[model samples]
Target: MKLSDLIAQFITDQLTGQDAVELQRSQLASRFGCAPSQINYVIETRFSPARGFSVESRRGGGGYIRIVRVPMGPSALLQHTVAALGEQVDQSGAQLLLYDLHKAGILGDECFCALKACLGDQALSAVPQPLRPRLRAEMLGAALAALAAEQ
Candidate 1:
């Protein structure tokens, strides 16, 4: 396996049965026989907010990296997912997020269909090509914010 994959798998193993895990980057590098920057790369790529994980790091001698698996509920996960989204998002990513929310019982069938229709490329086809992604992102953000506000 690739070094990054190995590192991600190691962290995944550590995350089982835990809400979060903290480790020293240098220690992980030493354990893997790789440079510390390699650890950073793995964390950045593998533990992304889109993937339902958050990584926070502290610099200096006593600093550590904390990897927290965001709670599985819809509100927290949806907030994290939407907050992490860039100004532009594609259809597949939006669908995946909505699907996750639906499966988690955060969205019912009617709400899911409504949001899916709103996010569809066809629905946004009237907009300029370059602006569609941003529009979709805005719509999603609004929807999520509404959901969050309802609670």
Candidate 2:
């Protein structure tokens, strides 16, 4: 795996419970010998709800970064469901799946928010009509992967 991927895996492995960890971006950046923005990029790209993880960050001095793991429903079954959808999904279908996830308590408020934001109208609005479905599917998949990883 790439160094970033290794670091990301380490961070994920470190997460053991509901309690979140407060990490300093600069510290991590220093450890990895990369820029702080690189750490941000890793968090933004890897720590997402679809992967079973969520991250909350605070700005300014003494700010803490918290990473939390969300549980997965039906073990690996949901992954099959997501894969079946492929790279294209309609709004109704996405909503229905998300609703199911919410009802199951596999997804919490913050997770819902992150998924919504990713699949939200604003993100979808910018895409061309023909590509919107595929983009939405990719976004959903990424978001779900991030959430699933947290578990």
Candidate 3:
């Protein structure tokens, strides 16, 4: 497993029967044999709002990082995914979000395949480099908005 996955799993394991886990970043980094920034990277990429987790950090001698698992319903999950897409999305991120929606039963296999194709690199490659992400986001947003409306 990747270091980030390991860190995320470690934090998840700490959340047994709890809403949140609070720990010192430096301490986690030391335990993982990595820099503090690696901890931050894991928190940012893995424990994001889109992934149903919230992260709060304090910086100081007594600083600590807190990770909370957010309970989200179907509508709220779709909303968070849309918001996370923002104004741009790369193929990989788009694919991941679509997979999440699929796993949540918000999307069927047909819809998943369609959205995946629309957001794939091959489809977006026809667009200019600078504008590809935005175009992908717009297409994805339209599709997700339609899904949200159906909900």
Number of the top candidate by lDDT?
1
True lDDT of residue 80, candidate 3: 69
Off by over 4 Å in 2: 17-19, 74-151
Per-residue CA lDDT of model 3 for 1-151, tens digit only, reads 9888899889889988999999999999999999999999888667765577767899989999988888987677677667767798888878877876787688899999999997898877778889989899999988887787778
lDDT per residue, candidate 2, 1-151, as tens digits?
8878976876776675544666888788888899888888777556654445557788777776787765556445356446545777777657666766676677787877677677755767877778877888887877666666666
Each prediction's RMSD to truth: 5.1, 11.1, 2.9
What would you estimate as the lDDT of candidate 1?
0.84
Q: Write the per-residue lDDT of candidate 1 for residues 1-151, one digit (tens) a residue.
A: 8989999999999999998999999899999999999999888666766467888899889989999987655567767877877798788778876776776677889999999999989898889889988999999998887897675
Model 3: CA > 4 A from native: 22-25, 35-41, 48-50, 56-66
Model 3, 23: alpha-carbon shift in Å?
4.4
Q: Positional deviation of 51 in candidate 3, in angstroms?
A: 3.6
Span of ten consecutive residues with least summed lDDT in model 2: 72-81
**Candidates' TM-scores?**
0.63, 0.48, 0.77
Top candidate on TM-score is 3
lDDT on C-alpha atoms for all candidate structures:
0.84, 0.69, 0.83
